[model samples]
Target: MMKVFDEYRALSDDTLKPDQPKAKRFIEAMRKFLDKKENWTFWLPYILTLELCVKCGTCGEACPVYTASGRKEIYHPVYRSEMLRRIWKRYFTLSGKIFRGLAGAKDVTEDDINALAEAVWRCTVCRRCAMVCPLAIDNGLITREIRKIFDAIGIAPDELKENGTRAQIQYGNATKTPTEAFKDTLEFIKEDIEDMKGVSVEIPVDKKGVDYLVINNAGDYIAFMETVMGIVEIMNYVNADWTLNTPDTGVNDVVNYGLFYSDAELVAVAKAQLETIRKLKPKVVVIGECGHAYDSFILYKKLYKEMYGEEMPFKLTHIVALIDRWIREGKLKVDKNKNPEPVTFHDSCKWGRCAGVYEEPRRVLKAVCKDFREMYPNREMNYCCGGGSGFAIMFKDEFLKFRMETYGRIKAEQIKATGASVVATMCANCKGQFREIIKYFNLPVRYAGVSELVANALVYK
Candidate 1:
């Protein structure tokens, strides 16, 4: 039983010290804010809304962490919420007065804060639990709000806080890759495109009047340069008018993880992307092979409008959708003979499930690969890679093992059963996660984006 909470329990040792001035100030502010709110306004509303939660454990069953971690209590959806519920009641609820035990009220110590921070950060907020919940309670959203409270109290996980601040303040990305590195990467991709296709392909930077404004993260350049080169090759082959924003090209700030909790910072970073797109005024904004970036563009567009008082004029399209459209429009030509071996696709959690971009990438894969195989559970129902929610960067070590044993295990088994030589996906994060897992397990399979495979198979004029 104790081992079940091992990952979660270890966090308590870093509990906030009561003597810290910042901790004391933040805690006092929270207590006073909760008290000022009409008991029914925010506090009771949240409690009453959450109390209807039947604890059917549907969410527990849906969480990737719970599934991968073997149904541990610490990974359970209700566990953290239940713990917070007790603390809320002990401090604020009147029912906690006469029947404290019945209401499950408990005082929130510094240890409680630390434990809750760890528990909440562990979740990816993928919202898979909401799909399984009969009441649509959205435990993922609750987890995010819990994270918000932690952020307010200055007790967020060190990695999350540091990365979030770096994203906002430093190089405008969590990884903080230098602008010089970004431009050098572009130059490298151009050289690769020339070498592969026998043509010098130009990927324009910050060019106005281009039909599409493409924003990609530095990850695309460093780890998945093939995909970046692929996009350029396809664009050149198709004669599509597009430009990359070198100055503000990194819109992949969605992994900041803070956005899942902090609305203000989320809006600020989202506005930065929009501002870049607005400067170009392209017909469409093509989000490169990153999923969460598209989430920010598609999901938070309205939020941006509310803040800025006008809707963005550009259309947000994922790169997969763009590639699929190119294939359909007869712009990019693929010769399946180049990739004669069998291949399977891994659906990205954000792109496939959250953003409903399942079919476009599959269509692109079907065109690129001679044989395309499906996993046991396909589309929206597919399991997470355990690294989907920024775990690829944050808890790389633990997430690598977890992904191989769980999501990657399933994917590898499916690929082996199909006798596929490669696994292809559209999302950059998926590419990294799958590639690492395949390497660690010594699986004889190469992983790439659908665009990269298509680019490799392209029949150039």
Candidate 2:
């Protein structure tokens, strides 16, 4: 029965505690990160967002963070959004320069930045707030900008910057999963596919001149190998000229944790993935069931134009889209009877809000599952899994408890209300989040990829 404000205040001890000796350094770095002239010149969207927000309270009701925290006033979207907007006005506005006090401007401190930094992490950057706002103020974008400012000051979670962005940029993937591991996993998947459907097909790798080059999170090879097998089965059934790169090739996975932490790191990691695509020269890049990866590739196209002065060398398509295309073409057939159990879909924030992909995964699910229940307030209006940012991976004890108890609890209740034995999602992060919730809360539900459900219903040719 702890209030959300109290729960968040507890996080302040750890998350908002600035290094007192380096307070000046943090302030300086924060300003530099927000510097309009050099580091970040694209400020018009941010400007419109800041000037546009009217604080009408529509966004508060729309936000999952606010609702999920049992209507916590701290998680209210306007709280952090207004803080950044005021900070911008205080330093960057002409009105503030002439009449600071009249303009409601104040000199912000290191402590202020620390509190805002923690607030940024509290949000999942789900963009639900903007969807309902009359002014189209994206608090999610504002939250990310705050995170970038923190990242510049060396104040972000180490899991995202170190274990995720740096690890992937320096060595290819977050785990640096071995080439042999990829090969071995594919071999096992092929055998499993044969055993299940009496079908056998070669898993393509490092092959040149294919129509598509697909990549997934390396975690798939470790735990959800069935999803990988699903992909291979559908690819074979569609007669796709697709390939998976060797792990040594440094682009086998398509995740960029930098999307959560900073723009610079997102650009660097995405450029690396694009380089591999350039080498392979595929017509399109298929990003497998990871929501952020779809978003990263979309961002990459813009970054590529800015850096290289041209459109990207390849195309990027979500795996859900690819499957939907095949189904529409009558190329990959599925039997709905294969999955008779009740099912529900969780629309990932990146898929619906970030990427405008609402129907593809749902269409596939409907075609494959007999009893597909819709989560209320679904599609672009759907709630977050509470693991959208690094919360799923960054597990400091207090943060873990907050994510489970405060943020993830609402989604659990939604699933339980449906009485669904299985909840399916396209994003690995969503699935991973729910997997933990299933065990920790001892819920009757389990998680599955949308692809896995389709694979279950696949009628092999």
Candidate 3:
């Protein structure tokens, strides 16, 4: 029995034992998830991980959840990966059929399936384990594969499945904001910009033939409009032609929750966004400060090929890269003295590690802030914000407590060590996680998107 870490609430399904019929369905689902080629992008790599992982336990040392939970065995990356590996060997491998116990294989049961579902969610799928594994096995891939199986069997969190991917696919945004309401929100942001800076800027929406079509996570309009304003400010200052897609275009939001779970849903959302992009005909599609959105756009080229049997029609890039270019090209004037507070950058896992966007945001920060500090083990090695893989939006009270008190503790300590008054990160999820961490840990620090700081430091000359 894997012990639950002290004080953290066990997941609701931790003790569940599915009835016979449900158990049969789960076993069938797992088998299909394992064998389906459509379900995976890197099928050979996954097989390599399943067959080659040596159980060295080096991955656990690099896992933030394991380290933050005081090295809880349950939260270890290999602990979760081992469960899936054992199940795979039990059902699919030749030697396991003959030498079950000796081969470390066991009979699949409702109890086992339930436990597997519970184990997969406990991880944030940051892929830090892959970074440390000597064999370069991606434990995050296993976790996501299990999640894909669970989602097929209707065993996923509603926050991610129902409100996240489902809502995004059906409603053009996860929030399900009406088209008119989205327009009203943009108008409100425009008014706020005028009020703050005494400038009247017309935000281009649904405009055709623009050089850039910028898509942010729809949630930013609700929770982080200031960050949206920041991007808009810089775009205007640089005289760059850009437009935000209206909901009518069916690609209003940058969020793609499928990146966290089902490849089917991932492709579904990507296809919808691609159709919209095809219609818009923008020179570039800019993903705003959401890590998964950045990750999703990165997959567009391959996904587009898989779907259309043709090349991706539009170019995609993250907003931070554009900000860095603008600053370096002298397109936007910035006064670093405008931001005097001690600031530190929290490298989001997908944006920095997975996307290989390490130096761009750091360079942008240095150009905009006078007292920028670096977190130890920064860039690709930086710890997760306890909010990757769509956990930031999940809000079960017990899980939230675990997210902050246990999973987020190590990141909180990292932030404290920087001694910065403001934490600058490019991912919205990281900012959301920091919101909880600041309150739970009672650290005297606030968080902002890097674009928000750049907007603050912009000098209109």
Tens digit of per-residue lDDT, candidate 1, span 1-461 = 12222332212224333233343443554464354242222354345435678888888887766776677787788887786677667756788766887888876665566556556656667677777788867677667666656656655554545665445445656667666766787788888778767887887777887888777755677778888788888888888788876646435333435455554455667666666566678898788888767776775578667767877677778778888888888888888888888888877778876789888888888888888888756677776665565555554324446556655665566667767778887776677777777787788988887778888888866
Write down the TM-score of every candidate: 0.87, 0.92, 0.96
Sorted by lDDT, highest first, which candidate order results?
3, 2, 1
Clashing pairs in 2: none
Candidate 3 on 1-461: residue-level lDDT in tens? 33333333223332232343366676678777666475467577778888898888899889888887788787888788778777777778888878887997778766667667777877888888888899999999888888887778776777777788889888899999979999999889888988998776878998876899999999999988889999888888887899998879887989888888888788888888888888888999999999889888888888788788998767888899999998999887899999999999998999978999999999999999999999988888888888888788877547788788666888888899999999998888888899899999999999999999999998975
Error of 1 at 128 (Å): 2.1
Instruction: Say which prediction, candidate 2 or candidate 3, comes out ahead on TM-score.
Output: 3
Off by over 4 Å in 1: 1-5, 8-49, 248-256, 396-418
* Ranking of predictions according to TM-score: 3, 2, 1
Q: State model 3's lDDT.
A: 0.83
Predicted structure with the largest TM-score when compared to the true one: 3
| Residue 70, candidate 2: C-alpha displacement in angstroms | 3.2
Question: Which candidate, 2 or 3, would have the higher lDDT against the true structure?
Answer: 3
Pairs of residues clashing in candidate 1: none
Model 2 gets an lDDT of 0.78
Candidate 2: deviation at residue 414, Å? 1.8
